[model samples]
Structure formats: C-alpha cells, structure tokens
Target: MHPTTPRIAIVGGGLGGLTLARVLQVNGIEATLYEADINRHIRLGQGGTLDMHAESGQHALHEAGLDAEFRAAARPEGQDMKLFDKHGTLLSEQATDEDDMDRPEIDRGVLRDILLDSVNPDSIQWGKYLKDASPLTGGQHALHFADGTATTCDLLVGADGAWSHVRPLVTAAEPDHSGVNFVELSITDVDRTHPAIAELVGRGSLYALGDNKGIMTQRNGDGRIRTYVAFRAREDWLTMYGIPFDRPDVARTVILGYFSDWAPELTDLIRYCDDTMLPRPIMQLPVGLTWASKPGVTLIGDAAHLMSPFAGAGANLAMRDAVELAQAVTENPGNLPAAIETYEKALHAYVLPVAEIASHHLDLMISPDGDKQMLALLKQFDAMAAQGSGGDR
Candidate 1:
C-alpha cells in the first residue's frame, strides 16, 4: 500500500459501506470498515427482501465482480406484485416472466453476505461503534468509539445510517417523521402452515390499501411472509394508542381493532403472525438535502439522504452511491479532497429528483384512495416502459 494513499475508514457495514469496500478492493484500494454489529451473522434476520434495480444495485454488484453470485441468489419471480383495496378487491396485478432479470429480488441478508464475503475479512473491524468524529488538522479526522478507543483516518465515510453521528459534521439536518408508522409482523413456514396466506401474497408482494391505512406483505426467500401494517398517524401513535406490543396476542387484537372494517382475509395475516412485532415510524431527511463538502469527510446511503421507502430506491441508491464514490477515489489517486468534492457534487444532483419522487409516492400510498392511485401509477409506469422499449427497437 502506498504511504501517500488516503487511509480511508468507512463507518457502517450496510450494503453501501460494504459495497464501497468491495469496489475499492477490486481497484486495489483498501478501506477499513467499522461495523457496530458483533459480526455479520448478528443481522441476518433483521432486514427483509430487497429488489435490486438494474441500474443501481445490480450495477454496483457488477463493479464489485459479484454479478454471477447475485444472479444465482436472485429471485426474478419475486417481481410479481398484487395490489388490492381494503375490501380484498384486487385492483391490479403484475407478474414477471421467469427470465425477467431487470429488477430481481434478493433477501437483504443474502446480499449483505455476498458483499461481506467478497471483501477481505480482516479489513472489517466488527463491534466497533462510532461515538463521535472530530476533525483534525491536515484533512484528517479522529474517530472516537464506544469502547474508549480512538483512530485517525485521512478519509471518513459515514455509512452509519439515518441517525448518523457523522452527519452533524457535515449538516445539521435531521430526519422528520413522515406521519406514517408501520407495525411489522411475520409468519414463518408459510407454504405448509399458511398456504392460504401464501397464495394470497403470490410469489412476491401484496399491497392492500384504503381508508388512509394499508396492509402490505412480501414473500421472503426464507419461506417467511413479512407484513407491514401501515397507518398514517402521529409519530407517537404506537405508545399513545395503548397497544400492548409486549404481548403478541393482545397486540394482534389491538392492531386488528384498527382494521375492523377490513376484509377477514386481510385481517388473517395479523392474527396468524409470529409473536414478534416492531413499530417503525417512517422518517425522511429534507429532500434535496446537500451540504458543504467537508475535507476528508463524506457520507453515503441513509446517512446521506434518508428518504421514505415508498419509491423502493433506498438500497439501490445507496449501492450506486458506493460505486460512484469508489470510482471517484480510485480515479483521483493522491487527491482525497478532490475525490470527496466530485462525489458529493454528483451525489447531490442525482439524488434530488429521486428523493422528490419518493416523497410524492409516500403521499400517494397513504392516502384514502391509495389503492386506486397506486394501480394507476403502475399502469403509467408500464406505458412508459413500453414506449421506451418501442423506441429502442
């Protein structure tokens, strides 16, 4: 390793941070990754499935030389989607062909494993929680960790996620509640134990929305059906509503009470879910968020632009960010400041339009006529795709 080469340190082991490490390694540039988890296996069951878009997630994997592995684990069938109203009336459905690889789905854990395995294991220092980062002279920063240890890096990349400790170093903007909350539930072994629910959800996703609420479900690669019971409510609704989330049975009843008027088939999901539930308040940083580029410091993924997942672009964008940042670093050898400036400029310009679209979709998804609006939006997207294909031909 060249002594003048930047000593890069990435904070976070998420797809973005891991991809950055992998891509940099592929280009013969090494970056140390600091992950809060004890190890890779600890977060195996935390995240749900992710659909890898062709231009972003898949592209990043290709750059990291993991394309073949991703294809082997990818589920093209998971592209299928069924949209319905609260009455169980199916509004729209779309199925992908077996060869449809444009946006194949892969479990989040699986993708993370692939990235984690590709990098040099020794480069990743697991169980290192970043408590703070202070700037030092000569474009360096001192990383203070939770375990009373400190390290210095010539380049600091904050991939630490939404509540990032590194974000304050660049911007004071914080994530705001999007007025929507999700109660996540799961049903394991769905094929044998809950065939009916399996059939209802099809091979991919099920979205039932109305009355400013929704019941969304997705089929995971692990033979589990994960569901998100969404409500357009105050950020504190979970606590103020008096849902005994600690007790699964009582919590199910309390959750179902909110959806009393919905169809029985839809309510069955909440009733049959496992004894675990998580309340997530949807949050997003101000769209078009940008900051002055701090020398030797930058951020990617959720730590950079925390947006609602309604547009399904969060993971894809994060991976793309990693790819671009890696390219900038590799292309501008011995000029860490120039690399940071280039990456930040391109990132700010690229994410603004996508962030606006995500915000718009969030509003449409949680509205009273969300099901109808979503169906129409799907049709519009299909028409645009067809026109683009025809033009290419």
Candidate 2:
C-alpha cells in the first residue's frame, strides 16, 4: 500500500472490480479486492460476447492501460450479430472488426484474465465472501468476511453483482425477477465436434426468436459456442417446472422439452451441451437506482445499477463506472464525500439512460407482441449500420 495513497476496499472481483483495481494501480493507488469464489479457476465463464461500446468498455480499458493486451485477445469476428426466426429463417445480419466496431467481442473469461493480470499479484484476496460491513469512526469501515477474517478501509466500493451484501448500507434496493430466465448451454470443441453449431453462430452471435422463447448463442474463442435457451415466464415458472436448475441432464431435458419441435441442429445445442448448465434467471434492481450520499462508501457496476442483459450494457456500464469513479477520486483528493458525489452525479446520467434502454429491450423481447418488435430492432440496427454507425462510439 502506498503510504500517501487512499486505502480502498473493493468487494467482488468481477470485471468491474478488477478494472477498478487496475485503474487505481495505474494511478499509484492500492485497492484490496475480495471475491467470493474459492479461486479464479472455479468459473466456467460461459457468458456471451459483450458489445463493449467505444466510449464505455474500450475507453475504460484504455484508461487502465490494457488496450494492447485486450486487443491481442479480442475476437473481432465476434462482433457479427445475426437474427433468425423460429423456423430457422435468417432475418438480419451485421458485422464488424477491430477497426470499425469499438465493441469487439472477447470471451468474458478472457477479459477477466487480462484485467486480473494488470493488477498487483497480491492485491486480489479470493475466498472472502461478504458476511457484513459497517462504518466506523474516522471515516473508516470494517468489512467482515465469511471466512473469519476482518479488514477495514477508508473507502469501500461494492463491485459485487446483483445480490450485493454492501447494497443494503446505501439503499433499500434489491433485485426482482425480470420474467426471463436463461438455461445456458455450451457446445464445446465446436470446430471438431459441433460444426453445425459453429456455422450457425457464424463467427459471432445468433438470436433465434419464437413465441415467448429465444435461443441466443455466440462463438467463443476456443472453437466453442456459448448458447442459452431463453424463456419468458412468471417468476415461479422454473420452480413449478421441477427442473433441477443446477444439474445438466435435468436442465437439458427441461430445455429441450420446451423447444421439442425445433430442428435437430438447433435442439442439438441442448443435447450436446456440457455438464455446466447454468439456470440464470434474469433479475434487476430498479432503474434510476440511487441513494443519499454517504462518506467513505459507494457502489459500482452491477452493485450499482443491475438491469437486464438485453441492452448488452452491463459490462460496458460497469467498466465505465470504474473509470468515472477513479477519475472522481483523483480529482477530489481527501474529500471522500466530494469524490463520491462526483461519481454519482456523472454516473446517474450515464447509467440511467442505458438502464432504461436495457429494461425496455427486455420488456419488448418478452412481451406478447414479440416478432414485430424484434423486426423493428433488427431494422433499427440496419439503419444504424447503413448510416456508417454500426458500433461507432
């Protein structure tokens, strides 16, 4: 720890926390990052390509001095977005590379690795789940971990995701079901085993939509494709289905049963899926999620504004928050509340609009009036592409 620098504690070593740590390190500030997982390798890292906008994700990476490393691993081919109908009819296509699209595709796992490598080796403290955290005198806070360790810091930032333990201290916000749950699947060794799926994903993303359901898939860097069997249902639907959400065999049956009539190639995405089936029920904190200012503590990333994945804004927004927060601290040294106030003031404007767009996209995707709404989205993207603005800025 730098003797004159701030002592910051970042909970949850996801993309957001990792990025914040890197940003702070580049500026000569030290941060201790706590993650719940036993270790980094415990993750399957199956989430699809995040379309990181130029001004958001890319900009944050640049600020962290990770642009070169990020580019080496970025999948420009993953920038392509393709839409299909339930009957396997192709409706739309859009493509980009490293030069044109700022939001180049990179596996979530790969991105985390690059960010993790940028930080100090000892900076991240894994296996520490948040048991509780509280404010102490002299603008410090005590953080208690589930593993019987305790630490305190002058500044605490919750970069943890949806179910953040630190959130209750700032606001009463919590996540509610978003009426959509994704049963995630992966066709590993796509080039060797699942050539059909490899082709279907077409170097990037595939969105096949139908009545109250969709199949979202994306090409991973490792010749594998991460896919999701998305369903629109009431919050209790999965519970009533009696499907073992964690087990692959059971979840696969529940998923394939829903799309029973789909083509063999498509349903094969479920059959050939690996054992790590993730039943990710979408949840979100209320948009415009904010609270009264408090000294020495704040939130970033999903801990701050958790919305649906529809808008593809989660990672970008979270990375952006890290950058803004770092800038805030740099500009207002020794004035903790002033720095936090600066962060929230800028964050509200940046996050609120994106969250609204995300919520709206999720609502439209799951609504009774679906197909046309999807077509409209396709058309909107086409129009943007036509104007030479596919992913510019």
Candidate 3:
C-alpha cells in the first residue's frame, strides 16, 4: 500500500487514533492527526477508571511500546469492584486483594496523557474539526474543516469516534441511543474533602442498585472519584429534568433529585460533589455495524461500533480494531484493496459477538425493571469473587 511511505491523515485524537498513529510510526509509516479540540491540556479528559483488559487494550499499548508508561499511571488497587443494593448492603466483591491481577486501572485523563506523550507533537494538528471531505484524484481526498481550513490526504482514517465524519465514505449508518441516560458527576479529593462518601464508595468500583435506577462510582487517582448515576428515560429527559447541562451545581441538583429517596450517605455525593454535572446519553451503532468498501477511508473505535458500556468492552474493542487494521496494512505489501477488504472482513467477524454481548448487557443494565438484572450481576460478581479474589488477579 506504499512506496516507502503513505500520505495518511488520521481523523480524531482519541485513544484509537493515537494508537494507530503510534503503531504505524513504529512500523515506519508517517500519519498526520486532525483533532477537533483546541489543545490536549485544555481538554480535561476526566472520567472513571478504565480496566485495561489483558489481551485487548493492554496488548495494543504493548504493541505501541507504551506499557511502561501505562504502568506508571496504573492504580492496581482501583481494580477492586463492589456491587450493592440501594440500601447499601454489599452484594459481592472482586479483585479483593489486588495481587496477581493483570487488569490494572488508570484514569482516562492519565491514559490520554501517556498516549499523547508517546507521539511527536508535530504529528497532530489540533482544532481541525472537520465539516466535510471529498475524494480528489489518484487516491487523494480534500478535507474541509469547520474553521474553513482545508487539507488533502492520500489516505484517510476515521478514528473520530461514534459520530465519525469519515464513516459515510464507507457506509450509511449512525449511532442510535442506548436506553440508559447517565448523569455523571464527580467528588474531588474524596479521602480528604469527603471522607464519608469515600467510606461509602471504598477503594474500588461501586454499584448501588434499585428497580429502575442505579449508580456506578469508582475511585480515581489523586484522591478523586467519578460517579455515574444511571436512569432509564426517554431521549429528551435530560433537558426535561432541567439539568443545566453546563453548570456543575445545576447538574448536581438534577441528578441528586433522582435519587432523593436514597440515604444521605449516597445523596451526599451530590451536595459535596463538584458542580460539573454532564448528561451522558448512551448511544451505539448497530450490533453488526459493518460497512461496504470505498477507497482510502476506514474506521476504528466508536466510529466503527459504538456500543453501550455495559460489558465494559468499548475501549477494548476499539483497541482490537486498531491492531487488526494495522496488521492488515502491514501484511499486504502492495494491494491496498486487498488490505482493506481483509481488515474489514476480519473486523466484522471479530466484533459481532462482542457487540451482541454489549447489547444484551445494556438491556440488563437499563431494563424497564432492573431488579432481575441487578440480581444477575450480583450472582455473577459473587461467582467471580468465589473463583478469584480480586478482578486484578
């Protein structure tokens, strides 16, 4: 697919985009990245701890030669997970001891920092939010940006996420909303600022459940913790609930009101939480989200298959796609057509099961009546805990 080098442009600066750029560079292929954000540091990138799986997410990091850096940011103790009822009774536990566990935890922001540091700054062009792109001539495409800037590329890759601009080049599809709407809020410096909430949350992931509502919280690095308060609602409920979308205090109030029936220890997170409340409407592409061929354009990560975070495989699957696509290009020396075909074929087969698992799990997590689903998770957690002490091991 190249005479020494391919004039490639990668759209997006998320994990999958950076992984592709880093891995391709390792193989001596140069690719430029276009990002929508103003700059890396300006983007907070804050969130919960991502449990980097052994064979998928971690393997991709190793392939990119960023494993040592990843370890530097890993929090082994954060892999410990707990499930509980609305009344705050412990149902089960996993990764209890945190020893011999391979799936280490890292804050989303820290993980992004490691990926960004691995790549040369010159490789990324920030604030290039794309509005439109078109095929030019002889394997080239012109990119039109929101800022009215333009550039051309010999090969374009879409790592832009679920709402990818590059996806339409290959297929006709978009992300559909998953049933759950997540009201995400955070508690800063839990060990110091909010000791009671920290005690309620402990050292790992927390799942407090009821029939239709639930809360998932996890301790993040630097004495901070992020919590997702989940509710099953129509797509428009976020606005209907008067969640001040931008102000943290307004969002905090809206989310707290949902769980007003619960204990003060649980609802206290809202009162003491940082005001940055954001409504996350869970969305995903089709389960078997595959697209037909078009020249010089392909996708990875959420852009390819954005599923619910139920099975916790969104990042894992995206990393898998990057590795597979890279191998396809690296393997097929001459025929670009053959390379893309092979990559797409393999990706379709590989992602279907995970997508199905993701869909099924989303249903359980956001069901109209979630009790049966909560019971299922409790049973699974107990089973896993009985088999192994901590999720880390």
Candidate 4:
C-alpha cells in the first residue's frame, strides 16, 4: 500500500456501498466499509428480488469483475410480469425466456452475498452503526460509531439509505412520505403449500391495482411469495385503521375487508399471508435534490436522492453512482477533493432527470385510476415491443 493512499471510509453496506468498495479494490484502492448489521444473515430477508439493469447495476458488477458470478446467479425467468385489475382480469403480461438477459433478476440477499464474498472480508467492519461524522482539519472527517469507537478518514462516503445518519453532514433535506404505504405479507413454500398463488404469481411478479389500492406480489427464489397491500392513505393508517396486524387471522380478515369488493382471486393473497406483517411508508426526498460539495464528504444512493420505487431505478442508480465515484477516486489519486467535486457534479446531472421520472410514475401509479393508467402504459410498451424498439423493460 502506498504510504499516502487515501484512507477511505464508507458508511452503509448496501449494494451501493459494497459496489464502491469492490470497484475501488479492483483499482488497487483500499476502503473500509462500516455496516450496521451484525452479519450477512441479518439481511437475508430484507428485500425482494432485484432486476439489475444492463446500463447500471450490471455495469457496476462488470467493473467490479463479478460479471460471471452475477450471470450464474441471475434469473431470466424472474423478468416476467403480469398486470391486472382488481377484478383479476389480466390486462397485460410480459413473458421472458431463459435467454432474455437484458435485465436479469437476482434475490437482493443473493446479490449482497455475492458482493460480500468478493470484497476483502477484513475490510468490512460489521455491527458498526454510524452515529455522526464531524469535519476535521486537513479535509478529513471523524466518524463516531454507536459502539463508542471512532476513526478518521481522508475521504468519507455516505452510501446509507433514506434515513441516513450521514446525510445531515452534506444536506438538510429529509425523506417525505409519498402518501402511500405498503403492508407486507408473505406465503412460505408457495409451490407446495399454495399452488394457486404460485400459479398466479408465475415466475416473476404480479400487480393488481384498482380503487386507489393495489395488491402486488413477487415470487422469491426460495419458493416464497412476498406480497404488498398498498394503500394511498395517511401515514398512520395502519394504527388508526385498527388492522391488528399482530394477529395473523384478524389482520388477514381486516385487510381483506378493505378489498372485499375486489375479485376473490385477488383477495386470496392477503388471506394466505403468514403471521409476519410489516407496514412500510413510501418516502422520498425532494426530486432534483442536490447538495454543495462538502470537502472530504459526500453521499450516494438513497442517502443522496431517495425516490419512490415506481420508477424501478433506485438500486440501478445506486450502483451506477458507486461506479462513477470509484472511478473518480481512482483517477485523482493526488486530489480527492477534486475527485469528489467532479463526481457530485456528474451525479446531480444524472440523478435529477431519473428522479423526476420516478416522481411522476409514483403519482400516476397510486392515483385513483392507477389500474387504467397502468394498463395504457403497458399497451404502449407492447406497441414498442412489436416494433422491436423496446430496448429495456
């Protein structure tokens, strides 16, 4: 190691942070990662499958030299999607074959594990939750951890998610609720235990929207089906509506009551959910969010621009940001501040348009006529496909 190699510290062990670390490693730049989880297993069931975009997520993997590994674990079948209305009437479906590798899907946990395995294990310090970062002399920052430990790094990267502890250092913006919340439920062993749901979900995902509400389901790699009952409601609807999600049967009944007028096949999703349920409020930072370049400090991913999932660009953009930042650091070995400034300049330019599109999609998808609008959008996509110009879904 060079004696003056920048002492880099990354907060958050998500795909963005891990990708940054891996990319830096490939370029012979060492960085230490601080993760909140005790170990990898803590994130085993964190999120659903992710469809890595060719231009972003997969590009980062290629930069990190994990393209072959990603291909081995990627699922082309998971790209299939079925769109329906509340009446269980299928509006449009996108069927994918084994060779459709443009946007292959991989379980979130699996991708994280693959990245973790590739990075130097000793470089990652697990169980270290960031408390705060204080600017110091000489363009460095002091990172204070919740466990009463501290470290000083010449370059500090906040790859943390929406509720980032590091975001306050660079930006004052906070994540605002998008007037939508997801009540998550799951059916384990869907293939054997719930054949009907397994068939309905197919190999990928299903979206059934109507009456300003939606029932969305995604099939997981472990024969589990994760479902989200989306509601365009107040932030406290879960408590105020008296869903009693703690009790499995009662919660299922109450949840189904809201969708009683919908088709029976759609209601079956909520009825068969396992006892575990989680209420997650959709939140996003103001679109076109940008912060002045703080010397020795910067942010990426949700820490920078938190947006709704309707655009399906969150993870993709995160990994893209990671790659660009890593390249910037590698290019300016003698001047980190310059590298950070260049990265932020390019980042703001790139994320603003994507964020605007995501915000627009969120509004349209959760509106009262979401099903109708979504159907129309799918029709346009079908037309594009027919013309052989549908590059990516």
Highest TM-score among the candidates is held by which one? 1
Clashing residue pairs for model 3: 95-390, 95-391, 96-390, 101-392, 101-393, 248-275, 248-276
Tens-digit lDDT track of model 2 for 1-393: 122467899999988999999998888778899999988889756366676678889999999998898888887778788877766777778776647555688878888889888899799898999998999876678999999999988889999888999888889889998889887778878888877777777888887777788888888887778887788986777767777866768777877888887766767778888887767789999988778878788999999999989888899989999999998887765777788899998888878888888888877766554555777977886689789887322
Candidate 1 regions with alpha-carbon error over 4 angstroms = 1-3, 389-393
Q: Is candidate 2 or candidate 3 better by TM-score?
A: 2
Clashing pairs in 2: none
Off by over 4 Å in 3: 1-4, 245-253, 368-372, 381-393
Per-residue alpha-carbon lDDT of model 4 for 286-320, expressed as tens digits? 98888889888889899999998877889989999
Candidate lDDT (C-alpha), each:
0.91, 0.82, 0.79, 0.89
Instruction: Give the lDDT ranking, best first.
Output: 1, 4, 2, 3
For residues 248-328, could you state the per-residue lDDT of candidate 3 as single tens digits?
766677677877777666677667878777788888898887777666778888888888887787787787777887777
Error of 3 at 76 (Å): 2.0
Worst 10 residues of 4 by lDDT: 1-10
* Cα-based TM-score, every candidate: 0.97, 0.93, 0.92, 0.96
**Sort order, TM-score high to low:** 1, 4, 2, 3
User: Which scores better on lDDT, 2 or 3?
Assistant: 2
Residue 114's C-alpha lDDT in candidate 2? 91
Clashes of 1: 0
Q: How accurate is candidate 4 locally (lDDT)?
A: 0.89
